[model samples]
Target: MTLLLTPVSLADRVEVITPGGNASLTPPAASTEPSDAAVETFPRTTAATGSGGTTYSPAEMDTQPGLQTMHFGAASLACKVASSTTDLVVINQSPEPLPAGTRIKWQLKKEGTRGFFAIIGELGGGESLVADDVLDGQAGKDDICIARVI
Candidate 1:
C-alpha cells in the first residue's frame, strides 16, 4: 500500500483606503512549490483626523488611526497535488486601526499548470470607533482556509 500526503499553501494581498479618498491594491507576489516555498508580505498606510480636528501623519497614525474599512484582493496559489487542507493568512501592517465589521471577500478558481485556484473570505469584528482613536493602535490579523476539494 502507498501512503499519500496532502499539501497546504497560502498567499496574501491588501487594499488600503485613505481618509483623503484614495485607494490602492497590492497583489501577492510569491509562490510555494513542492521543493521550494515563498511567502509574501504587504505594507499599507492611511491618514486620520484627531480629536482636535488635527490631521496625523502616517508615522503618527501608526500609534492609533481609528477603525477603518479595507478592501482586500483575491490571492492565487497552486498545488502540484491537491491536499486536504489549505490556509491563507492576512496580516495588518498598516498605521491605522481596523475595527470590527470589517469585511474581506475570496473567490475560488481551478484551471490547468498555468491553471489556477482561488478563494475569498470576509471578516467582521462588530466594533465601533470614537474620537481620539489611535491611528495604528488597533492592528489586527485574520485567516481563511480551503479544504477537502481537489
Candidate 2:
C-alpha cells in the first residue's frame, strides 16, 4: 500500500493587524514542511481585561536569538534577547492607563530547563518605557510564550 498527500496553496502576502500595530507574514510554499520553531503571532481584535485596569493579549514566541516584536492590545514590546539578556521597549497607545500593579509574565523554555518570569511596566495614556540589558538566566534561544491579561 502507498499513501499520498497534497498541500494547500497559501496567499502570497498576509497582513496581521492588532491594536498595537500590523505585521506582514509570508507563509512557506505548499510543498515545504512545517517549521520546528514556533512562529510569533499577534492578538486579534478582542482583548482580555486584567484586574489592574489594563487590557492585554498574548504576545510573541521568541524562537531565534535576536530581536522580536510582541503586541499586546495597545502595548507594543520590542525585545532584543541574547544569552539570557533582554533589552525591551514597551509602548502603550490605548486611551486608558495601564496600572502599576499589572504584571506581564513570560514563560521561558530552553534545551535543558524551563521556567517563568514576570516584568512590570506602568504606563499612562500614550506612554512608553525602556529597559535595557536586563539579565534573566532562565531565558534561552528556544521558546518564550507570553500570556494575556497582564
Q: After superposition, how far is residue 54 of candidate 2 from its true place, in Å?
A: 37
lDDT (Cα) of model 1: 0.30
- Which candidate achieves the best TM-score against the true structure? 2
Tens digits of lDDT, candidate 2, 2-54: 99989998875545679876643665445565553444556555464555544
Q: What TM-score does candidate 2 get on C-alpha atoms?
A: 0.28
Candidate 1, residues 1-150, lDDT tens digits: the string is 999998876765644767877633444344452422335654543455455543534443322224353343332221222121232233333333343434332222231111112223322223221212211222222212221111
Could you tally the backbone clashes for each prediction? Answer: 22, 0
Q: What count of clashes does model 1 give? A: 22
Off by over 4 Å in 2: 1-85, 106-121, 135-149
Best by lDDT: 2
Could you tell me how far off, in angstroms, the CA of residue 91 lies in candidate 1 after the best superposition?
A: 1.2
Q: Global lDDT of each model?
A: 0.30, 0.47
